[model samples]
Target: MAGNESETAQRLIKAFQQFRKTGRNEKKIAGFNPSEYRVLFLIQRANENNSEMKVSEISQKLRVTPPTVTQIINGLEKDGYIERTVNPEDRRAVRISLTEAGLKATEQARKTFNETILGLIDYLGEKDSEQLAELLFKVHDYFNQLDNQ
Candidate 1:
């Protein structure tokens, strides 16, 4: 049983490593890398409900540190893609929102991401794609459980 488990583990490791090649040379998914686009998307989602995000809120949601979020925010702000404003209710708190350019970038990124994933789904077939998604979620859950433990 241990030998079989070792072989299975080796196969899983190789499969995970090999899967990195499917990223299209990793040239910025929709004009931004995964981290950047995800931050933009989060702000965009908040904007839809008339809410702006704080650094701490973003950090919590992204499961990263405040400094990391601030670094991304700085780059996005430098590019005029996002803005930080002083909160009216709390002078000490700053809130983040998407700028016009940020909105445009976010929309384009969304379109490209959907198209790519949809293309992958078409290639994978509906059933296999569905199964893959389920299995991936299980993998995610396993890691999450490990983290909690």
Candidate 2:
């Protein structure tokens, strides 16, 4: 790789570091722990299209064990952020859906996170950031395809 490649990789690492920092601070602001924040993010994304998702599917997407996902789900349920429902296709399967409070929390977190990201994107500017996103998506797709293969 060339110097530009190394520079881009370093920039990517720095970007992730910034995201981690902002994410941690955002959780604090939302009165949620990092683990809970992760669960909320996953649930929010799964429901982005207003679709319900199964616990097993969530576990697979998160690359987390089923028991771990269940444990997190239990905590969220207790906190009233989510509720479990039976899958009609398979009564034995459980699905997770965010409650009103959960949706509100997710929206708040998203707003805060987006503001931070938008600031970064502004600094990177329109064309550069779009190019960066395109390149990063391609890289992500490449690795994902390789994993499946």
Candidate 3:
């Protein structure tokens, strides 16, 4: 049983590495990397809840440190994808929002990402894709539980 578990773990690790490599290559061809798209997605989601998002809020949602969030925001701001303003309620807090360009770029990125995933689903078939999603969710939940502990 222990040997079987070891083999399973090795296979999972290899699969993840290959998936990441493929994702990175695809993102490169698509113009925006996964991390950039994720930041854009998070900001867009936050805007649905409120007009602006705080840097700390983004950090929390992305599961990254404030500094990391700030770094990404800096790049996005430089690219004209996002704008930062002083929070009206808190003088020290900075609020972030997507610019018109940011929104457009995010929309394009989302469309491309969805198409790519749909292609993968077609390749995997409906049943296999469903099973993969369930397994992935179970893996995520297991790690989340470990983190809480």
Top-TM-score candidate index: 1
Q: Which ten residues in a row have the lowest lDDT in candidate 3?
A: 23-32
lDDT of 3 by residue, 1-149 (tens): 99999999999899999988876554541466766788888899888788667778878887889898888889999999999888789889887889999999998888888897899899999999999999999999999999999
lDDT accuracy of residue 15 in candidate 3: 92
lDDT of each: 0.91, 0.83, 0.85
Error of 1 at 131 (Å): 0.3
Positional deviation of residue 1's Cα in model 1 after best superposition, in angstroms: 3.9
TM-score of candidate 1 to 2 decimals? 0.92
Across residues 111-142, which tens digit of lDDT does each residue of candidate 1 receive? 99999899999999999999999999999999
lDDT-superior candidate, 2 or 3: 3
**Regions of candidate 2 where Cα sits further than 4 Å from its true position:** 1-38, 41-51, 86-91, 145-149
Off by over 4 Å in 3: 1-10, 20-29
**Clash numbers, per candidate:** 0, 0, 0
* Inter-residue clash pairs, candidate 3: none
Superior candidate under lDDT, 1 versus 2: 1
